[model samples]
Target: MEIVQIVGFGLIAAVLILVVKEQKPLYAFGIAAFAGISLFLLVIGKIDAVIAVLENLSERAGVPSIYMATILKIIGIAYIAEFGAQIVRDTGQESIAVKIEFAGKVLILVMAVPIISVIVDAVMNLLPTGG
Candidate 1:
């Protein structure tokens, strides 16, 4: 459907860039960037549905809404960081991309700390310490 068309066009754009890059590197760079952005924008159309499903699943699992929200934020940070890193790499800035990825990992870990603490607390409660 729409996704098929978007993928098809994205592939065509990629191929075109590859072909065009040999003679016009500047144009190729712009085209590659534009293609990447367009694909991301197209995929964004489905993000809402995905988020809704996650929320429903989280509720059904009896998990706290705050945990679910944090998880979603972590996921958002991951995807944005990955996307940013990829774009930076595509522009030949591998060092910056690595830094971006590192930052993303750290942020994700930070966001996960509360959930980890909750798990640790639950396990501790179940341990049944000696009186």
Candidate 2:
């Protein structure tokens, strides 16, 4: 059933791309992007299920919850950044796309800071302190 839906959508997207290519190139790009987003949303339910499974596995394996959350956050940020960059590029705003990518990187770094600080603090605590 899922495969059928995916193939059906893929075909529709291909046809839209071809039609838009002849008539409106920009709109062709837009349609392509819209198709991608639509497909993503369609499969988002599977993502939730996968996350639940991963959470269960991580708990059974004694993995830290924070680590799992951080990984998921990173994945989310990467996906969003890529999507934004592609849209900007499609709109012919290369400079803005570059800035958007830079901003995404900065945001990811900021988000990771807490994990980094924790590691740094742990290492520092392990060092012998001279009185």
Highest TM-score, which number? 1
**Predicted structure with the largest lDDT when compared to the true one:** 1
Cα RMSD, each candidate: 1.6, 3.1
- Candidate 2: tens digits of C-alpha lDDT, residues 12-125: 998989987988987898888898788878876788988999899999999889978987887788778877897778768999999888888988898888888988998999
The sequence of per-residue lDDT tens digits that candidate 1 reaches over residues 1-131 is: 98789889988998998999899988988998898888888787788899899999999999889999999899899988998899889889999999999999999999999999999999999999999
How does candidate 1 score on lDDT? Answer: 0.91
Q: lDDT of all the models against the reference? A: 0.91, 0.85
Error of 2 at 101 (Å): 1.7
Off by over 4 Å in 1: none
